[model samples]
Target: MLAKLILRNLLHHWGSTLLSMILLSTGVGIISLLLAVNKQVEDKFNRDLKNIDLVVGAKGSPLQLVLSAVYHLDAPTGNISKEEAEKLLTNPMIEQVTPLAYGDNYDGFRIVGTDSTYLLKYNSSFSRGSMFSNPMEVVAGSNVAKKKELKIGSSFTGTHGLSKDSDDDHEHFKYVVKGILNPTGSVLDNLILTPVESVERVHSERHEHAEHEQHEEGHDEDKTTGKQITALLLTFRSPQAMFSLPRFINESTNMQSASPTLEINRLLGLLGIGMDSVKAVAATLLLVAGLSIFIALYSRLSEKKYELALIRSLGCSRMKLFTLVVSEAILLCLAGFAGGMLLGITGMYWLNEKAADEYSFTLITNNLWNKDQFLLLTGTILIGITAALIPSVKAYRLNISKTLANA
Candidate 1:
């Protein structure tokens, strides 16, 4: 009887009831998107950083080392000699190692030169052809393969530096697209990998030209300069080495080492300011939703005072009347929440598609179902009950003679 009464009461003002529902659903959808974005950012970072434990680079910002080494999103602070990196790799604390040579690009995509271990460590297998067997032989990532429209045996000259459309093109040397990696849903998905020796040779020729251009007869011929690596990724003996080795590198050598775990946290903290503000706006919207429930229910209750008086005359208890109004509020909120969720999910998929095209940041399509959303639903329903409380109390008071007389 109560459920039937509740449904009928909501149906009495179907337009207003639906308005409440719309508010709740819109609020919930916004909340869901915020939570999913945070998860996406962190998950993608971890996905690409599966193999690297320690990033050894020239002394600078730890975050810089991480961004440069792992994502190729930042310029390197400087390079380290192969000899210094090799010596560190030989340390008993280090399990395995690979050096990254950056600072070259092809059509804005970063060119990475690392040993074969980079592919082996990530377990990245080629979809076509094979890994670089010798210098100047390059393997493209899935994004590179698809974007550049290249296949095995295709040759392309790489441009200099991280920037798109570099001022200097290493026109003398062109790399053969020897292979292409299958998609790993990582930063590696966009990289072009060649031999470290190729990178060294390009810089070597540049330095020699610069000296020759100066036309200084004997400017202390730079011999110590040979193959250089932008950064080195080290695998530690155990998790303990993550902490111990960074300290060891900082204290024992002129070189700097950074742990990805620490640097990633620091970066996240810096990034959260914008995310936090957006979340705050989402929270404010939910608050407006709750207030909407309160206002809509209260306004409808005013028109029902005479009806409540008539119900009391029919022997329906005041408590039952109150429960009915509260129940109506809940129905509206729940309907709105469900509608919002469906809309939110559809929008998320579209957003992901756009982001993939515009930024190449792959977003996984997964519906959000978490504790935060559960709590949100519960809290919205509770607000509905609170909104109906005063009306319920008024029904309990009845004032049957006065209400009927006034009507």
Candidate 2:
């Protein structure tokens, strides 16, 4: 009965109630969306950076090197000589070095040329088939296999560049899908892995072929260099190496080294500023919604005073009148919260699709509700109760005879 009355009252003041709900919902949606995106982004970064102490790549922005090498979110700065990168493996402070080569793509999914260590780093195992054992054999990530419909022994040629739109297909070489990896929920889930030699072989042949064509045109020039890999992912033997190695590599070598943790933290700090600004705006909207609710309830109480008094005269308790007014506010807030959750979830789904399409990155959306959202609910309800308190108190203390005579 109380709920029905509250609903009917809100409906009677539909315009103001809707305005309040929209304001509150917009605020809640913005905050909720930020929380969801931030959580998944942090989780993805932490998961992918596991055990990776440093990244050595061609000289460029350290953040770029980390983004490209660790997350595969950008193009590599350039390629480093394989021979030069291999020298770091012999260092006493280096426990492991996984060299990565990037040059091609299949259906927008990057084909990463690294050894089995890459899979082990992500704790990935085969869901079907076996690991690549020969040149031109590849292991597909779970996403690649599912999206591209690659089966074991399936053959596909890679485009010459990292993008899906590249028309320069490597028609001379056909790569066979040797395996499909189980989902690891890391960047590996969006990559196709092959031995470093496979990438080296493809590019090497392409270089040689281009040279032969140029020679036939009477431009007798020899342009040759050693094999190169995009970057080197390194794990340190001691934590002290984290402090020493990046500086040493940047100062002493042609290649630049970046720490994933440092770069990611810096990135998050930059992102934090933008998030904080949006939160402030959202907070302002919430404040306005609270004010709107207060005004609407106060005005409605003035108009309904006589009705409230008549009910009191018929034996309705003062406490019930207070409860009735407060319940209306609660209902409005609950409706706003429900609308806000819907808006937030829809926004996340759209963002996830966009990220996957553009960067081969997807956020974990399986669990949307968390402790933070629960806090949001609590805060929203508190706003409602606080806004209605004065109006509810007025109803509780109403003079039945005076109100009736005035009416």
Candidate 3:
């Protein structure tokens, strides 16, 4: 009977009830979506940074170097000579060094030039065929093969720049798809792998072609330099190397070194500022929602006083009247929470689709249950209960004789 009464009251004041729910739901949905995206980005970086110590690249921003070399999400600073990078590999403190050479792309997916060790870093294995053994031979990442419809022995020419829209095509240098890699859900899953020499060869040819064109046009061409690698991903043999190696390289050499841990934290700190602003907006919305609930219940008390008094006169307890109002508030809160969760879920699906297509960064879609989410839900319920308390108290203290006389 109490549930029926509460339902009727809410239905009769459907405009106010729906307005309150819309405000609450919009707040909750924004917060939930932020949480999911932040968590997924952190997870993706942590997964991809496994077993890496420092990135050595041409002198520029450390963050850019890390983002380009480690995450493969941005353009490289510039290229450093292979000879200069090899010297770092010869450092006694260095355990491993994998050279990266990248300057071209196929359909917006980057082509990375590295060795077999790059495959081992991501725990990737051949899904078909064998690793590239010759210049211009390439191995396709799982996502690249699936999306680009590449197979063993298939050939594709690369565009000159990192973006798919590059007008400069390397038509003469066709890369054969020598292998396809198993999906490891890391940065490697979006790249096309080839020998570093292949990248140097293609760019060298490009340079020669440009020079030839300049000569034909009676323009002066600058002197060309040696073959260059984009960056070197290094692992150290000892903790002592962290203390000295990156500092020494930055101070003495033309190459700059960036720590994965420091740069990633710096990136997150910048992201936090934007996220905090969003959270503040959501909190403000929630506060407005609380105020709306309080108004809805308080304004209805005068109109419902007679009905409430008659129910009390007919043997309905004062506590029952209080419970009815409170129940209505609780129901609205729960309904809003459910709607918000659905909205958040839809946002997550959209993010997953974009991430997968662009970066091959697959977010864990199932792990939505967490302590923070629970706390948010609990806090919202408390807000509803608190808003309903004052109105419920007024209903409980009603004078049956006075209310009926006024009516």
By lDDT, who's the top model here?
2
lDDT score for residue 52 of model 1: 85
Candidate 3 per-residue C-alpha lDDT over 1-407 given as tens digits, one digit per residue, 9 for 90 to 100: 77888888898999999999999898888888888778878888888898889999999999999999999888999999888888887789999998899989999889999999888888899999999999999999998999899999999999999988888899999999999999887888899999998898999889988998999999996855687999999999997899999999999899999998899999999999999999999888888898899999998888888888999999999898889889999999888888777778887788778766666576666778797789879978998999999999999999999999988
Judge candidate 2 against the unseen true structure and give its global Cα lDDT, from 0 to 1.
Answer: 0.90
Selected candidate, larger TM-score, 1 vs 2: 2
TM-scores of all candidate predictions against the true structure? 0.80, 0.95, 0.93
Query: Against the unseen true structure, what C-alpha lDDT does each candidate score?
Result: 0.79, 0.90, 0.89
Please give the TM-score that candidate 2 achieves against the real structure: 0.95
Off by over 4 Å in 3: 352-364
- Lowest lDDT 10-residue stretch of candidate 1: 356-365
In order, what is each prediction's RMSD in angstroms?
A: 4.2, 1.8, 2.0
The window of 10 residues in a row where model 2 has the poorest summed lDDT is: 357-366
- Name the top TM-score candidate: 2
Per-residue lDDT of candidate 2, residues 1-407 (tens digit): 76787899999999999999999999899889988888888988999999899999999999999999999888889999888888898899999889899989987889989998888899999999999999899999999999999999999998888889999888899999999999998999899999988899889988898898999999988875589999999999999998888888888888999889999999999999998999999989888999999999999888989889988998889999899999999999999999988888888888888777587778666688899999999989999999999999999999899899887
Q: 229-332, model 1: which lDDT tens digit per residue?
A: 89998888888887688888888776788888778987888889878988778667667777777777777667777888898888887778777777777777
Model 3 steric clash pairs:
none
